[model samples]
Target: IENSGDLIRAINLNGGSTMEWLVDRGGGQQIITVTPRFDQDAGRWLVGILTEMVGAHTERRSNPPWVALRDSFVNTWELLVLVKQGMSGAFSQGSAPQLSGPIGIAQIAGEFTREGGLAGWLTITILLSINLAILNILPIPMLDGGRLVFVMLEWVRRGKRVPPEREGLVHLIGFAVLIGLIVVISANDVLRLIDGRSFLGG
Candidate 1:
């Protein structure tokens, strides 16, 4: 719920005046619609309240006396990890979606803007952010989440570590796969642009 609230707030900040409620359909499909009650002022107020709560908690911990500093640090670390996991889970699903390249995203953004005005563009931006967060947490080599996983394995094994050569190879493979996906998506974007279905007034 917190993550959803944050996403809503971000969309509002980006000039969205309508909320598009989405529901999952079978087999990765979704049903979405724009609602009338998502006024910008209400969204901003919610964001401000959440921000204040977060800031107050941090300030209280920071000003604690010297003797409590270590305990505070430990608590803060645990809280941070929980928050991060929550955020990651909010963005991720069991499988990856079709990845979009920069060109594809630009095309989609423009299309949305043309179809539904500012609110549509804002919705697309929010979804893109969620997609980006999910992609980063993938267990592919060279990503932060992948490194974190390796560290966990090392801890569990009490001494064993992933070999440097194997790690390098994994990263290289992931990089190549990512590049190929980008190329394919970009080509699709170009074709869509030529078909006049992408971008606003193109």
Candidate 2:
């Protein structure tokens, strides 16, 4: 009964490809034949459904106090999972970790403002802190990980150090590229802000 809505169809499977469902949702129990749909781009069979269930009584107005801590921990863990997938190139076709600059940041902040204003800002801040900490651990030049790489190299060579000038040059080049990427992403963000559409190539 909780799953009833505007009468979205339901599916029943018995550990095989065969399927059945109930379409009429007026508290009737008549079952009907349902079929999964296939799409070309996504290349998957979708059993179209809205699975969310709401309470029979009035919904709770606010969360319990303990929910705050639980939510924070759960959200942080979810971010960690995404970060791991991102590092593994799960989100990218070309193996580059996608970067968004200040403009994207501002748009996301604006979204949070709509959700709960001050509370949303606090959540964004915590999320950003965790993301930055994870990014800082990557072995990219001009970052903490880059500096650690140099130290490791020296250790491998038993104190024979590479010239500071060469290492400095590499860092300078990497920093310039990073700045260029930020500029491009920021420009995209500004365009998105102006037109209210993203550069996500929709």
For each candidate, C-alpha RMSD in Å? Answer: 14.6, 7.8
lDDT of 1 at 61: 32
Candidate 1 residue lDDT tens string, 5-116: 4454344333323445465468576756443222232222122222222433211234558757776566445444434433433344333333357987887787888876
lDDT, candidate 2, 55-115, per-residue tens: 5554435778899789778767866865554444323333345456887877776677666
TM-score of 2: 0.62
C-alpha local distance difference test of each model: 0.58, 0.64
TM-score of each: 0.46, 0.62
How much is the lDDT of residue 108 in candidate 1?
79
Ten contiguous residues with the weakest lDDT in model 1: 38-47
**What is the overall TM-score of model 1 with all chains considered together?**
0.46
